[model samples]
Target: MRRRKKKHEDEHMDESWLIPYADLLTLLLALFIVLYAASSVDAQKFKELSQAFNEVFTGGTGIMENPSPGETQPPSDGEVKSSGAEKEEKKEKADLDKEEIERQAFLKDQEELKEIQKKVNEYIKTNNLEVQFVTKLTDEGLLLTIRDNVLFDSGSAVVHSADLNVAKELSELLVMNPPRNIIISGHTDDVPIRNAEFDSNWELSVMRAVNFMKIILENQELNPQWFSAKGFGEFEPVGDNGTAEGRGLNRRVEVLILPRVTD
Candidate 1:
């Protein structure tokens, strides 16, 4: 009976063989689980898990672990460079836009000035006056010229009767289109003058400028806030006083209109 039982036990199982087979099955299951986990991992999550495993096995703290609340993710080298380049491109585009706007505004101002010049020229042409009028565009704005003989008597500060109509017409034009600032400057030849009412050419020139201002201000539509008068006398001469033609050219009054930046 004992010999028969031993033979049945041997046939049923071997203890050493069972141990090795169970170990092999456990190794295969573990290997399959590792492979599955690896397949499911993304680059960002895999990096985090790899750092955790390294810390556990080596008994050392990982630099990538335990980030502060305010700490940002490490940027890739390519991403960092691309962001900087994008910022520079945006700044350049903004600067270009600003320059274009400024250029357009400058062109618009020039067009308005040209229109004003045309209107003033037409008015002078319609009047059959003997005085020579000149118009020019300058940095200060438009300048209009009128000979002294057209407005004033010889060696006198008084405005002539025939020139009254001229003054009234000019005043109307100024009222219609107001400039930023208006300056009336009186100029005289080198000839000296002395009288009971005036001491020298300077005083006579100043009186002439004042009288011209009075005529312009007489118009109720004109604003006196931006108007001024000055006398240069014999100091500022457009031509030499040695000749008759040059003397006539020096004896003149100039009206300057300044542009308004706000407009």
Candidate 2:
């Protein structure tokens, strides 16, 4: 009977160790579960998981008490560099888009100016005024140059009585849906003037520009605010001041139609 009891006791085989072994296995399983969840869960969940681990471990401390690998951290150098590159790429794209828009606007403005120039050229041809008038489309805008003799006598600022009809006809052409700013500038040859009516060439030039602008503003359809007058006496010349033909070209009144885009 004693031998049989001893055999039973030996067969018991220290089963108490199984409790700690099972606890170790449970801890390992929980650790693996936490590791897997940390990869996919948000920071709040990760912090909750850490708290659970601390409660399960000794003295409210555990390996998970430290930050999770997936938790918020400073950006790596490569990530920072990539962010900067993306910002720069976006800026370049925006600049390219702006440039394309400006290019399209410039093309449209050029076409409009060209159309106006063509109309003026047709008018000049129909009236046989090519010798006294010229039109040019430049970067500044449309420039319509009329010989001084066409509108005024030598050293005079008045538009000739016969030319009043011409001025009125020109004013009729300026009626537009959206009015543009017009600058009437008078230019003169280098010849000095001291007449009874005018003290100097500067005064004569100024009067000519003012008179031409007044004639243009006489049209009820035209806005007086859009018209301005200036004088460039013997300066801003387009021709040589020494030659007769060049002097004839220089002594003119210029009508400059400014682009609407500038406004």
Candidate 3:
């Protein structure tokens, strides 16, 4: 009995058993605390704690709050795309407007040319003088062709009585609707000439052009400053000089009316 009592006192003095019991109680207390936290979770407090931890780890500001509920801001990417599209549309519209204005201006110029052509055609038809004169619209201007036989004698640069009436009628029309500039060009056949009065076809053609210009300038309605005369001799022939008809075509005087814009 004495030996048993001594052994029981030694066992009671050992602290190993108390340590295991304290550990079990501590684990049970931790489990209860976890269950209590799970049962009564605070969403706002959790979010704040999570944000604070993220800010500390990332070294940045906390998450921002939405300014208004159900009102989202437009994305920067989408805004930039829309702005570029609008600018492109405006640029295209400006280009279209410029093209339209240029087209209208071109049409207006064409109409003015047509009007001038029609008026000259009407004057030619009304006078019943198509046999002695030829009129046509060229790129340069309106051309009036008068036969050399009608205006001058062979190898001479004299203006005849019959030619004066023809010149006067044409001058009257030109004065009525004056152009920016008028050029009287004299031409002759390839037939060579050697005479006491004139040296060659060049002199004869130049004299004939001058004589015709003098008659046209007699009318005060015509502007002398806008008129000029030139002689081509047989250099700028309209047809081949091999045939009689071609020679007739070549031997003619032309009146060229130039546009104001060209001047």
Instruction: Provide the TM-score for each candidate, comma-separated.
Output: 0.64, 0.75, 0.58
Candidate 1 lDDT, tens digit per residue, 9-32? Answer: 546555688888998997687567
Relative to the true structure, candidate 1 has a C-alpha RMSD (angstroms) of 8.8
> 98-147, model 2: which lDDT tens digit per residue?
88888888888778888888888898999999999999987789999999
Candidate 2 local lDDT, residue 38? 79
Error of 2 at 260 (Å): 2.7
lDDT of each: 0.78, 0.87, 0.75
Best by lDDT: 2
Model 3 segments beyond 4 Å from truth?
Answer: 1-110, 176-178
lDDT of 3 by residue, 173-247 (tens): 676454558899899889997899888888888889999999998988888999999999999999889999889
- Candidate 2 vs candidate 3: the lDDT winner is 2
Worst 10 residues of 3 by lDDT: 64-73
The full ranking of all candidates by TM-score, starting with the best, is: 2, 1, 3
Of the pair 1 and 2, which is ahead by TM-score? 2
Worst lDDT window (10 residues) for model 2?
Answer: 1-10
Error of 3 at 204 (Å): 1.6
lDDT score of residue 115 within candidate 1:
74
- lDDT-better candidate, 1 vs 3: 1
